[model samples]
Target: MKSWTLTAKLYVSGLTFLVLALTSIGTTLWVTWNLEGGAAAVNEAGRMRMQTYRLALAASTSGPSGETLALIRSFDASVALLRSGDPSRPLFVPWSEDSRQRFRQIAETWRQLRAQWTADRPTAQDAARDAGRFVALIDGFVAAIEAQMSRSTTLLQGVQLAMMGLAIAGVVAMLYAGYLFVLNPLARLKRGLTSVQRGDLSTRVEVDTLDEFGQLSAGFNEMAQTLQSLYGSLEDKVREKTARLEVKRQRLADLYEASAFLAKAPSLDALARGFAVQVRRIAKADAAAVRWSDEGNQRYLLLAADGLPAALLQSEACLDTGMCLCGQRRAEASIRTIPIVPDPAVSMGNCQRAGFRTLISVPVKLHDRVLGEVDLFFREPVALDDEDRDLLDTLATHLASAMESLRAAALERETAVAQERALLAQELHDSIAQSLAFLKIQVQLLRDAMRREDAAAMNGIIGELEAGVRESYADVRELLVHFRTRTNEEDIEPALRTTLSKFEHQTGMKVRLEIEGHGVPLAPDVQVQVLHIIQEALSNVRKHAGAREVVLRVSRTPHWRFEVRDDGLGFDAAVGHADETHVGLRIMQERAQRIAAVVRVDSSPGRGCAVTLDLPAAAALEPAAPALGALA
Candidate 1:
């Protein structure tokens, strides 16, 4: 009736059924005992009547014999037991007043019959009549017990019917209670669980009672709410991660494209313009400009500009004086954002007039040295965050590196041109110029001989002049061949072989070229100069040494050494002469010195000639020699 736990309800129901079963058992046992008691009394009364008849017959027939006397005693004991009211023994009977009167009459008849058998030995007719009356009374007593047993049987049937009705009613009540308190709520909970299993987190058990089911329902609802909240938060986190991945992917693509563009740009201006365009696209800015320091002129120069108005582009105040917004910000040596305000000192009035609202300046730095600044302009007042600033800073760094590379390339080109011109001038002065001067002197001699009217001298002088002219023409052709020779192969061995083959073919002399340390590489400029020096040595051997055989040996150990040995009619080195041969020797020495190499001439008048050039390993690998100033 009141709210209780499931355990308490079950305990109470079990106890009630136990009590009802015990009551039914007790009632059935009591009714059965009363019925058995009435039947036993009837049986006792019938046995007593039969014993009294037998005693009467024996007395009438045998004239009070011993058998008759024993029968009388036995009969008397049975009647006394029937009349006793002892409740302990089953044979004892409790009788009403009418049954007691009937039992007394039977008892008195048995006594008269026993007295007649013992004292007078009555006639057979009297004895028979006495027996008849006793038998009739016994029958009446049995009839009374039978009637009482009938009443007990009817009461037992009534008790059994009442127990059956109570058992049926209890069963019905138990089933109904179970349905209301247990089965119905269990079904509801089962349905709610099914819904939740199907992903319906909104489903909740609606049981509202102060019981176990109520507490279970509340806990289930709390769990569902927690799950829903967690699911929502997980979705938010996934979306945030997806967005971040997309942004990182886009940034990677932009960096890749920027690196490709910057690498191929040919000059500083082109690199700057390309870099500005890429940065503007990456940062989503309106305009971009690059300005670099002109240390030579002590001013900053605008290298390139993109998407800026013509009026602002034409303004030379920023270029002439380092008073512009980017120039002022370059001193900070970091990326910064500035508002484009009308300030004369800052020189941003042109930017303001051009409708630019904000400026993001990124200093182009190389190893902590600020070379320039890249300026990004925006129409709206924009605040540049760290990510935006970092992007611009990276672009500026790449731009700075490209600019440095271009500068180095331009410097190398100019140095190469100057060196070539100096080499050409020295070659002309040493060979062709001297030969032309000698030819002029020979012509002067021929004119003098002709004026003196000596035909033999004039003819000899003409022969000398023709020889000089031929020698000069040969020198010019040799110079042309040397200058036209270019080493296009990646390795120097091929070029060396080509030069050796040409020398062998032109001079009609056997030239032996032996190379050691075959794979050792020399710098491009070093290889070129060494080859030219070798050519010069070979030429000297051909023109002056008058040698039949020459050996050109290029060996590399700790350093490189170029040797040209000739078994020629050698010249004396101690006696110096201002001749074409000495001039050729001087040109060879100068070529060797250009690469920081040392040259040695081992020769005598008639023995042989051995010219060797030894180069340091470092100078061969990296030819950082200064320009030749004045070669004597």
Candidate 2:
């Protein structure tokens, strides 16, 4: 390519300016010659003819009427040049010869009229009357001619001045064009070329013209363009390398996030799931799966996976571990292969057939032992790079550590549960079993005393036997319900109602049982405890109070509320404590406490007694379950 300098283009533009200046000067001279000569001739003719016509009119005015009229008309013919009138209308300005001749006739007639009036006026008195009218008419004609002459003079002067101005403007425009198109463009090109020569290959020239100058400018532009393109390509390569570095940095960041997540995972399943999720995001894989060795088995179990078919994940021998498979095939395998199902809706490659395709299974090896393997797949086959393999290996190590800790925790929880069950067994045998045995012995003693009939001896024995029997009964009932040898499963409401009704049947006392809401299922231990409480309350009513009717109302919300009201000879409950006679009351209070319920008694000397029990519904249903109470 050729280069153009500022001096070469500026010299060409200077010649172009000189030619334009000369042409403008020649044009101005030609226009001046035509306008000045033509306008002068017209003005001279108008002046001469106007003076001649005025003199001729004056000369004919003093002759005889007919002869004077003839003289006025003949000499006034110069007024035939008075062409246009009413100048504002389109056809009013009479420029044609025929129209001018018609106007001459009008001027001639005016002159003849003046000659006749002058001839008829033989005296000064008559002449004076018409003189004023004749003078006024002549004055109007002269004024009209003068005004037309002035307009012609102004128009010619304007034309001459416009020609000169145009010539000057043309010269100035040529000089400006030389600077804008040639000089400025060349100057820019010179600086740009210098920059390019100094190793700034990105510099470029700006040229927009259409002559020889423009052609040279275009050549310089092309040269700069070639250098710019060469350098731009090199810069693009650097940017590509920088972008790859950024991608590697992002991968390192993802690894740290995965490490933090693994540290917090509490179980083997959670750790495996977290590893698979991170792998899915980093690789942009369609699905990810993890398989680990089961604790006591040689076979691999699928621990976790995303977007894998449930049937294939659960099926035996679905994934291959690289070592055994590589040995069998006589190949040094880096990753094992399996069919991984991609979600049809989410997979980008929807044009392919619907099913599993290729999978890349990389083993998670911790030290010398193979803990598990991770499988990643795409809708289309993906070729793994060395970086991908290494990153996966790091993730696998972290996941293995997390899984080992989780396994140890599971074993610890199992041991704790076993110890708790053992302690519960010991408590039930030591306390409840012994109390039930003592109750059975005392019941036999009471029966034996009743059989041997001796009057005073019988009376004292009956009192002793009744007190002993009451105490033994309270102990035995509490043991069976709360500290049970063998727990029984019974619904809470039916058991409670049946126990109260049985006491009424035994003593021939009227008892009313009312239940509200619907019956719910209860655990056996909870039901037994609640039933014994009701039994104890009823026994207290029979033993101490000489009341007739009793009402047992059972209400259930999220918890149970049992109320036992007896119309018995009530005692002041606050001032007294449970003795051998009131041992049943003490048993009822103890049973309510064991079940995490509240028991209150309302009694007075002359009023009836009402015992109320409010237990959490879960406690009234299951001994071990946590209670969900009502909102209020």
Candidate 3:
């Protein structure tokens, strides 16, 4: 009647059926007890009647014999058994008024018959009549019991039929109720679940009653609604993610293209123009401009411009810090965006007059240092989004890196030119210049001796002048050979040997080259400088030291060391003489300084010269430009 959970409903149904089954079992037990009692009574009555008849026959045939007395006693005992109600023998059926009266009459009749037989020996006719009467009474008693048993059997059969009908009806009702209340609802829930598994979020279960099944159905419907809402929003989230991935892919492709273009742009101006074009295309801007900082003159120079008016490009070619929109932002070293407004400031007037409504200025930086700024212009009054700003920032960074690389290359070229000039000056001062000066002094003395009209003096001076001219000619040829020398091998030893052999052949001097720590690495620039220093020292030996032999030793143990010692006339290196010899020493010192090396010239007027150069081990191994001689 009341709403119940599935478990409670099932329990109640089972309890009701159990009660009915117990009732039927109890009824069956009662009927069986009554039938058993009636059967026992009928058996006892029959036995007693047989004993009475036997005793009467014996009394008639042999008046009061021993067997007859025994039969009488047995009959009396059986009668007492029927009459006495023993507590041990329980009765299943209570004795009704009719049954009790019939039992009492049978007991009384048996006692009367026994008393008659015991009192005297009657005639045969009398005994036979008494026996017959006793048999009749027992027979009537048994008939009464049989009738009672028949009634109990009939009642038991009816009770069995009734209980069976009730049990069958209860079982059928229980099964029907289970199907309606539990099975049917479960089937509906299963169907809904199957639908949901097939991606049908709209499926829902019907709530028939306020029971567990109803609650479960309600929860399932709620879940379906939630799933429907989530499924709908999932599409939007997926779309958002797809769009983001596409943007990132496009950005990566743009960055790859820009990097390739920047690497091969050739010049800073070309790089700037190419970068501006890439920025305009990637950022969807109407125009773009690149401006570089000229810190020496304190001006921002317009390096390149795209999609801008000629007038504006000319006006903005060069501007001082804070002179215009780009310059003002560059001075601050920050990125800025100019929003479109009716009363826009005149600082961006040039861009506005060029049909640009919005501007974004991004500072191009190498680390924290700003090299320049790139300006992007839009035709409409469009606000820049974060993606656009990010793109511009990336472009600016690439531009700055490219600019730094170009500047480094230009510096390298200038440094090489300066080194060549120094080498040329050193060569002239050490070789041709000194030789020519010596020859000029000889000619002057020869002219003086001839004017005195002294033949011996004139002849001696002429011979000295002839020797000086030959020596000068030899020096010029050596200089020419040195200028054309090339050290194509990575190792400097072969180049050194070649130079020394040429010197020996030309001067007719014995030269020796010895190397220790042959595998020690020397920077190309350091090696070139050391070799040139050794050559210059040898040249000085041939010209002034007048040494017969020269030894060139190169070792690399604790540090790189080069020594050029010659057995020739040595000069006082400490003397402050404005001479060509000191000029060559100064040139060697400058060459050592370029690679952070140390040069020591040890010599005296009478002793041979030992020139040594030492370089530190930790210097960068940058390759120097080939010597001027190689260039020639």
Candidate 4:
């Protein structure tokens, strides 16, 4: 039955075969047991014939003797064996009407024979007659037992043949049942599994029975259906993911291009225009506008825009913060989406009148400060998602970084110009200003000498005035050359040679430049400071040292070292340590400090002055990199 599982079906079929096999075995055993008893009974019947002959002999030989008595008792036992079964010996007739009658004849004949043999002196004639009758009865009993045993043998053989037939029939039935219940279903299930393995989700197993395998087939079909349903939508899911990936890839490329362009942009306006173009292309908007706010965050100027009407760009070129949607102050960093609505009451609402329906304003911010904003306008309404908002914000960020960089550079340039002007004023005070003061004093002396009419004093005063004029002229030329010169970062030898040659030509003094062990060259800024210090030493030599010959010694390793020695009228180092008297010594010390170098002056009242510059070994290993041309 369909309700019966495989276990129940097999159990019932197996039980039927077991019952038949047991019945056959039990029937054969029963027949064999009956034949065993009949065989024993037949054997005892045959032994009674021998006892009959022995008894006749005993009767004729001696009457009432011990031997004759024993023969008689033996005969009695044989009869008793046929009458009652010897269970231990298994000696019994197969009880039937013919077997019982035959057994009774054997017992009656034996009793008569025993009585005749036991006579007081029995004659041979009587004994022979009794033995013959007794022997006939024993033969009849054995024949009946043989017939019953033959019947038992035939019945046992029949039971064996019936069992064999039952076994053959059972085999045929089980083969059919197994094929119907197990093999056929399994073969179908296997085919279905193969199809599924080959990627056919449509393959299904048909369930014809409510067995375990049938439940398995039903479950398999359900699984295949689910797979088919899921696979139907798999292509759409893949396409969706691929489209999203494309958007992300495009976003990355745009960000990379914008960052590179902004990083190296020459000016703020240039950076803003380039970034605005990039945003317009990426967002596919109608018009893009970029603005930069002043430091006060109060007023902002429209820096650049890619696609905007000339009229609109001019009108919105400059606006105050909080005036329009694009220029509104921001509390948090986020993209603002505005729907432009034309309203006559609104004073600064020019977007809707310009045929723009949507306005997306993204603020350009650096960390916490809002620098400005970028506005995108669309004639048709536009929808912006989180990704679109993030992209606009990132573009704004790049713009902010570029603007900050340009502003910082401008400020640096102005600061440098102011510092150089201050240096010039100091140079004038140290050289030209002091020289004119000397000229004024000498003119005063010359007038006094002329009033006195003393020839000797007038001649001396004129000569002194002539020398002062030459010194003033020389000081002006040296000051001009010092401020105009530039330093080379790669090597200092060329600049040193040029400075020494100029010093020799201007002072009309023999100059010797001695260079020592060299290593990696000094940076341009360091070279600038070193050159300034060296020139200051030369100025001191020309003004006061009165040296005819000068030696500039330079050493680069194991540390940077320099010495400016002059064979002039040297002053006391202790007394002339004042910056005003030593001619820009304080300026030289300041320049030395900038490069981490030490400047020491060695001199006596008669000996020449030598300015020594020493840079420590540790500082010379790796030069610092704060702009090579940033010395000013």
Candidate 5:
């Protein structure tokens, strides 16, 4: 055969696919044309049926013998024509044994009817009337022809559907073949090239076929092999240098991991304990200890010790600054090494002739203040290199940072708590304290009126005290709700509704809470702020607005928006945000700022007021903020 290249193979496969497609369509068309003959056959059979009925009627009635004979001859010709089948008309019964036998019986019955009627024309009424059976036989033969034609039609439809299926199958087969011959090989080559690009020198592509793609794969394997050999020889030349670099890399990795572990230690003791272990491992020392010193650097306390001799650790558990190598004064000594000699006279000053051969102490300091010191003791004599000293210095710096981080976190909590307390105190002074002062003044007035024996004035003072007491009780509950605001991100609606209900109940004002649109709820912290702002708006409505109804609408349109509307005597919202004379509006603004939200008030003096909080789109997807307990 000629060279069987990929193009030739594709050409042959495509040509075969086309031939199969055309053959299927040609078969369908031929079957369709052949079916036309069946239609004509059905027509002739129906005419034979009508002629049989007419001939019987002519013989049964007093018709002329000539007409009766003529009808009989016509029916006989019809039956003979059907028996002789017409290939030119393309009409033929699918003559199964049953149909052939049925036709014979039909022909025989017609002959008997013709013979009986002709034998005695005047008295042949019964025989001629019996022609009904012969006509039924003819009907059976016509039905057989129709059943065959119907089968032919079904076959044609099947051929059409099969052609469609073959077309689809051809496409799928071509695609699958292309994948095997082209896409799969290309993909393999691409992956090999990518691996080589990523520094994989030993990557090789498989060469299975002798096509162009296979040749390409073969070339790729050769290139990779060459590169691998070249790189391997170059690597051998610099093996020592590379080993040193790898050691440094591993050293840096260890320092980073240890620092991460120390940073997340949660407590100072945990930080010290892990730090001691890490230092001993990285320094390759036998024993290690961590000590904390006072700010004055006058005394040191053992915070954590690892692999230390029990007797030595117990004896040197606490020490004054400059007592030993580990507790040296900050100015006189930095990170220093000391040789441990077997000195019997130095009982407590030295290790008392323990197994330690050398001691390397580094200060865990932040700036000039020495927060702690890490002591490394080795059983074997070890020489210190500059890199080893630098490693120790980095580990010490990380320990210092970890300590400071813990202190800063503690300070932050204390600050939030202090802020919360201040806010509580201020809210109390504004609400309940003022209301109590008013009630006290009313009580004094009532006492004076009673002493003077004035009934009307005493009654007025008592009513005033009652109203003041109710107002003060309501204010205390509102403050409790405000300070206790806690919720999950999904419970924004529930929290807002709770606030609205409380406002409605405390102040005999009708509240309408409506939720519209749809979206994921805001972050938990954002929801907390939103709930608080809504509560503040409702509180303003209750205190200042003299209207009847309040409507709080919460909606999410890409971003979250909350609106609190009231029907009370609206204050000039332009007069700063809903009576800015009070600290409530200021608190609302601060809360909005924390979660990247905006607060606005729309109102006129005679009309109602509406306070809307619009949170930006990006803020909704944010994770919940750290729980800063209701500072509002």
Candidate 6:
């Protein structure tokens, strides 16, 4: 077990010893004082009884043969009875056996005299003298006992007061000694420890004694000095390492950001601009420029530059062809300096612009094919390091990769678009075209009946033509809507609103919608599935139920719930299940199941239908507007 702290041990030891000493002394004094008090009380009671007996005898001597004699006899008998009372009761005593015998003899003599006086009237001169002597003797004995008890009480009180004074003095001395030895030292130690804990390594406790506490303070001070030295050395090492790492990390981040931009650039001009920005940040250059290689190193074309005037960037002839061109002709791993002289033809004869001097162009090559050259210019001549040339080479390599990937992605998107167009073409030919052909045939038959001049045949043909036209239009419109929708990129809410609004507008029914909760965008595939499910539901309601008023509620809780209620004639959904009249209802159920959504249809023969669809919130999304293809 860990040893207790010195302060705790000292406190416990001092308090325990002090308590024991005080308790023992206090108990002894209390017991002695109370015992003495009990003895004194008994002595005083006995002395009072003896004094009363003496007074009774004296009264008896004064009255020889009267009622006073009888009174004296009664008093003497009462005292005798008290002396011979229960053994459990205390009796007064002298330390001598002779004094006890004398008290008993006096009691006997008083009893004989009381008996004679009570029997008859008597006069006795000698008896009165003897009784007076007995009374005086008893008075003296009572007085002596009282005096002894008073003295004993005074001595006991004096001893108790002295013991109390000693106890108080001892407690005060202990407290004073503890304050000087324990508490003051402890307070100093605590303040010193707090200062050290707060990082003040120079703070040290004053050594007042050759003890363990002084040793502890010295050890703490030594530990603080060690920590401060170690911290200084570690910080210096970390700063040196961090500075080196930061430069390399910045270079890498700049390369990646430039590569990302080049990959997405629409044209070569965008790529050149992005490369200029990245190189300026990486090189920490005052001015930078990119010069693309012409065919067969015939000429160098200035593509982009940073910290240069817009006029110089736009004008190709502004750069010195001699200096800018030499970078392409230089050795692959060589760095060359060229002097830039402002061309009078392109510089526009501005006196302020011609003052810049010294150009260093680094040639950019990818797999031995020279792509371009990056040129830097400074006001004063500066030497270029191998690391600087290496960075330029790395940036050129990344640009090449970005350009190649961009070409590949463009080709892939084109191929995918071609395949999707072909599929849509076939669907339209199979569904919509055939429906239109059949409607045309029905129209021709109606026209033929009109030429025959038969009224009943004409009327029947006209009725068939009208029915075919209506059916063909409904089928073609539905097919066209389905074909135009791009399921992979469709949104949910717009599709729902479009479908519900179409129903209300076409059927002239009062339809209201209430939407709630935070609507979030979802993946395109999930948006399509939910939109189709909503369309199917409302289509069934419009076809079967003659609903005048319909309410569409789209809300999101932990999950999305789409509820469509209609106040119209309804049929048993169970009966509709057995019968296949409502194929739309079956389609709705299948679509909801495919999306892992719940569908509830409540209806009776006379009541309305309430169709509720709940889908996962993660799968619910807002609808997208129809694209140009959809409009077509």
Better of 1 and 4 by TM-score: 4
Instruction: Output the TM-score of candidate 6.
Output: 0.36
In candidate 2, what are the lDDT values of residues 1-632, reduced to their tens digit?
A: 12444455556656765675566556555444433433443453345345444434443455355654554455444344334222222112213343344345446655565555545533444444444444444454444434544554565566557657756775777677667765776788789778978988767665555656666667877877776786779788889999999989988999889988988987676787778888888878877877776433244667778776555455533334333321111123246554434455433232124253666767666555666667676677666678877887777778777777677667666665664455345434443454455556655665676676445665665676576566556544544443332233345555555566567766788988888876566556556556666766776776678889999998876567889999888888777664533455665676677677888888998898999988876764466332211000
User: Residue 251 CA error for candidate 1 (Å)?
Assistant: 3.1
Off by over 4 Å in 6: 1-264, 267-386, 393-401, 404-434, 437-455, 467-499, 514-525, 540-545, 567-612, 620-632
For model 1, the stretches where C-alpha displacement exceeds 4 angstroms are 1-230, 296-300, 316-334, 341-349, 365-370, 443-459, 514-519, 553-562, 571-578, 593-608, 612-632
Candidate 3 segments exceeding 4 Å error: 1-91, 94-246, 296-299, 330-333, 419-632
Winner by TM-score between candidate 3 and candidate 2: 3
Against the true structure, what is each candidate's TM-score?
A: 0.58, 0.33, 0.62, 0.74, 0.51, 0.36
lDDT of 4 by residue, 74-160 (tens): 777777777788878778888878878987776666666556566566788877777787777778778878988888899888888
Clashes of each: 0, 3, 3, 0, 1, 5
- The residue-level lDDT of candidate 6 at 390 comes to 75
- Global lDDT of each candidate: 0.78, 0.60, 0.78, 0.82, 0.79, 0.63
lDDT score, candidate 2:
0.60
Q: Write the per-residue lDDT of candidate 1 for residues 257-310, one digit (tens) a residue.
A: 998898899877788888878888888889988888765425567778889988
Cα-lDDT of candidate 1: 0.78
TM-score of 4: 0.74
| Deviating ranges (above 4 Å) for candidate 5 | 1-257, 281-286, 294-299, 307-320, 329-334, 342-350, 353-355, 367-369, 384-391, 453-459, 490-498, 501-527, 544-548, 554-561, 571-606, 613-632
Model 3 clashing residue pairs (backbone): 483-629, 545-569, 547-568
Report the Cα lDDT for residue 496, model 1. 81
RMSD of each: 10.9, 19.6, 8.0, 5.5, 30.7, 21.2
**Where does model 4 exceed 4 Å of error?**
1-240, 294-301, 309-324, 342-348, 443-466, 484-488, 491-523, 541-558, 565-571, 577-581, 604-609, 617-629
Residues 123-170 of candidate 3 have per-residue lDDT tens digits of 888888887877887787677677778888998999899898987899
Model number with the top TM-score: 4
